[model samples]
Target: MHEMLGNQYFLIRNYFEAEKEFEVGLLSDPDNFKIKKKLIVCYIQTGHVDSALTLFHNIVSTDPKIITDTNPEEDNCPCPEIIYELESILNNSEVELKTLSLAMLWLYCDLEESIWYFEQYYQFNKSTHIIKSILASLNKEINK
Candidate 1:
């Protein structure tokens, strides 16, 4: 019910309303990846990049497979508008590198762009060995 309403609101570009509905749905089914992905799109559309990035990190940390798994039959890309918005955010000087890296990864940005973002993030915050491994793995995956 909430998911349907959220989808309707999303279709109409009422992202705030969609966010509310998706949030409600998430509370009930916290493990629903589809709902979580929808909510991330809503957050991105509504200019809540920080929130979206946080949720993105959570989702990736819980199930790294989500980053690698792709379903050819489904349109799994984030909405084009949201992708544009995230690109704008990434181009800005003040955005957080970690957030930018995760956003680019989630949006399935070009491999070069993803590598750049990840490199920038690593240069800024070198303490996270996990990010380095993830970057290495992403490079290996993309090369294949």
Candidate 2:
């Protein structure tokens, strides 16, 4: 009910009130991806790119497979829009989106991002050999 009200407010361009309602919904349902997605959308709609990115990272990190087989309904799946918007912001170019699309050919589509994360991990602990090995395998797969 609260989510629906928030979504309604969002559709009517009342972002501030929508955010309040969504926040309240989140208070009750911390694990509700649906409400989280709505909140993120409200942020984006309000030009809160940083907030949206934070939410995007949270969602991506926690749920690597944002689009699973169980949720076939469009209303339940905000992943497509989330991915599209993030790709636009992250890449901001036709060429870059093309590159990202190619990179997502195999694996979980966020594998490219994982590679970036692994590089950061390597920087912190150069002696950890597993990260490098997995990176090499992923690189080989990406290149092929």
Candidate 3:
């Protein structure tokens, strides 16, 4: 039911509503990859990059093989389309390097690459409190 409504909202480009429904669905079934994927998209559309990145990390961390495998029975595995969209976002010029690091982490890129991006962003934008806060959060999360 929530999935269907979320799909409908997504089709209409009403990403906020879709996000809400998907989040609600996830509350009941935290392991539902399909809903998580949809919620990721919603986060992207609504500029909730941090949330999207965190969820993406959680999803991949839960099943690293999902990044490459495509077994039909594995409904939790992300589809190629979602991967492509995420990659596209990572490549977009408007996306900050910190955000790119999160996406890179999601794609299972070298941890060093993510750290490098974050460090570069921090070095260049030290005045940005959000970046500082994000760096602190990332550091804590990565170290854990």
Candidate 4:
């Protein structure tokens, strides 16, 4: 119930309110991966990148323990299905989702996909120099 409301608020662009709901959901079910992921997204949407990054790092770090034969660090990025879901959200009016997706791609040095998402984000929200600079750097790297 709380999770659903929180996610609804997030989709409606009410990040602060969504954060509260997600925080409550987290308190109730600390190990719910879906809730955790949505909380991370809410953090990112609200410009709480440190929190989001911490969560991302933790998820990646812990995956190896759950899947014995898998080397989480070697993967170098979140699962492709996660990426596709995020990218699909980005294709919607979720500009913050696009930003986070691009940031993840950039963090992974996924130059090609980063450039694609960044271009789409830039087209929608042209106010940020940070994203533009990232796009420029990625473009330069791709060209090189």
C-alpha lDDT values of all predictions: 0.65, 0.55, 0.60, 0.60
Top candidate by TM-score:
1
Q: How high is each candidate's TM-score? A: 0.65, 0.46, 0.52, 0.47
Give residue 58's error in model 2 in angstroms: 0.9
Q: In model 2, where is the ten-residue run with the lowest total lDDT?
A: 99-108
lDDT tens readout by residue for model 4, 1-144: 888898788666577898899889888888766666656656765768667756654543454122222232453223344556666676577576556555543434354655676677677679966556655655655676
Candidate 3, residue 86: the lDDT equals 52
Give candidate 1 misplaced runs (Cα > 4 Å): 64-78, 85-102, 109-112, 125-144
Higher-ranked by lDDT: 1 or 2:
1
Lowest-lDDT window of 10 residues in candidate 3? 68-77
Clashes of each: 0, 0, 0, 0
* Residue range 90-131, candidate 3, lDDT tens digits: 655765643544443433334444456666656666786655
**Distance (Å) between predicted and true CA of 105, model 3?**
12
Residue 67 error, candidate 3, Å: 5.2
- Residue-wise lDDT of candidate 2 within 25-125, one digit each (tens)? 88888888766656765675565645654554465456535412224244433334445655556545544333322222212334666466556546656
TM-score of 1: 0.65
Question: Considering lDDT, where higher is better, how would the candidates rank from best to worst?
Answer: 1, 3, 4, 2
Q: Among these predicted structures, which one has the highest lDDT?
A: 1
